[model samples]
Target: MKGIVMEVYEDKVIVLAKDGSFLEVNRDNRDLDIGQEIEVDDNNKKIRGRIIKRLASIAAAFILLITTGYGVYGYYTPYGYINVDINPSVEIAYNLYNRVIDLKGLNEDGNILISKIKNYRNRTIENVINEVIDTAVEQAYVRPEQENVILITITEKKDKVDDEKIYKLVDSHIKQKIENTEVILIEGDNNIYKRAREDKISPGKLMLIEKAIDLNKDIKFEEVAKKPVKEIMRMIKEAKREKEKKEERKKLEKKTEKEMDKIEEMKFNKSRKAKGKKEDKLEREEIEKFRKDKTKKDEEEKEIEVDKIEKYKEKDQRRYLKKKSQDEFEEQRKEKQENLIINDNKKNQDNKYKVDKSEKKNKSKRGHENEYKHNKKERGKDED
Candidate 1:
């Protein structure tokens, strides 16, 4: 039965099943959390099961231990060199406390391998090496169930570590963690290391290349060395597929960028056309306004000219009327003078006639008087 651990106690664990039933399993607390998954061991009547964690951790600690107490006798427990050659080479040295004391890279490929397993230092060398192999297998550095050659050499004193102890610790661990790989152990003279230095390749890589050459006599080490480990492992087929995929992805991205640029250009052209239209409209309105103002000014000027002409006509008419009145007045005055002159002449004639009549009367009287005086003179002379 599989269940989630609800609680952990000193001697038991309470697990919650999927059916909402609580089960108390009588087992030692293995640092299990409340939500840890566990399987019930069917063989044991005591409801005991393994607590499964992540796949990586499970692969790292695949070995089942016989003894329970995790103990080290001293602080300076030294486990000598463990040289691993998978085409990459690595040599790891551990102290009694399971911490890494020194590491050596046999070649360029081995350099980064040390960094991969460096964190496992100061821990148990068994589980640490298990983690290294498991991680390497997952990363495709080592192909399990394939023809990869591995050579392991451990050198230590009898008191510190023995052959059987080292063999039991590493041999089964590698076998259980990795599969189908030829493992070679060297106690005295390591010609593999000498061969690696001469070839300028790691011992692990040299082993693999020689193994491949053994299968095909026509293949040369120089030709195989030109290819990387992953390419060599895939035999050149997968590498071609990966390259093609990368090229396809790049082409798709370039096409997408081109489409986006075209869209932006179209938008910019649209905006430019809009702005041009707006400017043209404003220019047209300005032209209309200017024409209207010009027409208005012309009309006003025409009105002003018409008013001036009307005023001039009125002034001319007034002047003409004044001149005619003056001429009429002068003609009346001349007529009046002529009439007065005629009247004066007639009065003078009458006066002359009256004076003449008076004179005539006087003369007639004088004549009569003269006649009477002649008669009186005749009478007086007769009387004398």
Candidate 2:
């Protein structure tokens, strides 16, 4: 059946068929737009339809709807298209709600992405596209380490999603995949051509180079792309110099800190040595004082012992002098007594001689005999 689109809404659409019957249909196809013809197919009164883009003749639509006896108009949300061509070429049509309404894999290489794309139906386009690219990377269709070129075509939508938003969405999705893959992005649009004209650079090279610059800010898009390798090397050398300077500064700081620590350690050692020396000096002083005290005490003891010995000698000398005096006096007295006895005997003999000498020779003889006898008696008394 065929119908002319009459009314459109967010979720459904109304179509006026040739039988003058108004039909409502669920909108599931993304390609359907306003002011378009459609063909409805009925299987057991269940209706499904697709928009016919090339069919613009209203009379032909009426004749087809009359013959089929039933017709419906299908509504689909207006959205943009994202065409990704790696080794695999896939077209994804999404709605304003970011839903994947249509998907097509144009080549045999697309099987990797196609198999995974179904899992993201009616999901956000960014999420679904990210999953698809990830799947492609996993399957090695898009090599991760090598230079993989991606061509993105975005159909601009008004009052819904802008060109910038779509471009960023596509770029983010592709970047989220193939972490080690170096990507070269080629944008197909008048915007890329305009930038190319303004920079006086080729559009193809400009877009890819700009993308490279966006990915790595180190590459000055305007400066290094057209310059020789020598200039690029110079730029890299300058960056290396900056990095070296930072490292040198850090090394210098560490060296300074180390030097300070060494100085502090030396000072501590010096202080400890000084303190040890002071302690040693005090110990030496204490030892010297003790020695002095001991020596003084010994000298005092020696002096005391000498004084005691001198007193004992003086007492012994006095005792010996007294004994000698007594012995000398007694000897003197005995000598005198013996002298006196001798003198007395001499006196007595003188007195007796004077009496006897005169009176007789005869009497003298007798007296001589008597004198001898008296001498004998005196000898006996002396002996006794």
Candidate 3:
């Protein structure tokens, strides 16, 4: 006889059927309760026919399970989703059924419905389950296999962002520019993005963009940049150099003007000296002409004196160091003229022919000496 029966264990029933069976089951969570009667079939009542064999059935089921888990890549057409096991890293379970359905290529209405559910992320496992139920309510019921339901769902929760830590870091960056930088950059939990639990765009990236828009949107970066002490000193030195260059340029201009003035003054003095020399030459020529024009001559005596006078006139004027000034020279000349006053001891007219060559015509005997000739003539007549 062949037999089929159910025995309860752990609030669930397990079915066993036996007919010449092997009960060497390796792995199954079906432990039979002791002293429970199982349906049996016997032909001779000596255990030779058939009996309930739960172990054999469990062994067969286990062989099928491992084979399915390692199944090769293929199109999976699922009439309904039963139990599903998720990777531990996938924290959001609301996306589980939709991902599987999309991979399977479901209908249009089904796709949209799944998408809405996946968009709703729940922080906890219970919330995720509720969300999945809600998704089912939204979709019109098309009855599915009773055994096809979620079994195992693993999740990785995102780490909560510590606002305090973020605030400190932001303040640190801001404090570099402003004396009192305590403005908040991140507002709440949305700023915290967990990579393992979710693949989301980094929220902190928008911090710079947000800062671009503000009440006073004057973002100055130079103030934040730190200047090295050496660099600052270098700038100061450069500024000083520029100032010195300006001052030096002014000084050079002044110096050039002074040099120009000196040149002009020297030219003026040279011109004046040239004019003085020309005037002095003209005056000396006029004095010599005046004295020559006033000259007189004696008829025969004058002829003899003319050769001597011509010789004296052609000779260079004697350059004698003045024994004294013009006043002294004039006084001396007057005394000498008075002594030559046709003295009663007049020796020159006494022996004119015997006069020595040096005394021959020591003074003028022509026009300039006519005044002397009149004295001599008067004295000679008196002697006659």
Task: Extract clashing residue pairs from model 2.
Answer: none
What is the per-residue lDDT of model 1 for residues 1-384, given as tens digits with 9 covering 90 to 100? Answer: 676555578888766555444566776634444444566543423333353333224323321221223433233344455666565666666765444555666666667666665334334455555655665666677776566545565544334545466556666766776666655654522566467658765544555566666655566788887554443545434545666788999999999999999999999888768888778788789999999999999999999999999999999989999999999999999999999999999999999999999999999999999999899889988888
Q: Stretches of candidate 1 above 4 Å error?
A: 1-79, 96-98, 157-159, 189-384
TM-score of each: 0.31, 0.29, 0.15
Count of backbone collisions within predicted model 3: 7
Off by over 4 Å in 2: 1-78, 157-159, 162-177, 180-384
Judging by lDDT, tell me the better candidate of 1 and 2: 1
Angstrom error at residue 322, model 3: 82
The C-alpha lDDT values of all candidates are: 0.62, 0.61, 0.38
Task: Name the weakest run of 10 consecutive residues (lDDT summed) in model 2.
Answer: 69-78
Best candidate, lDDT: 1
TM-score of 2: 0.29
Scored by lDDT, model 3 comes in at 0.38
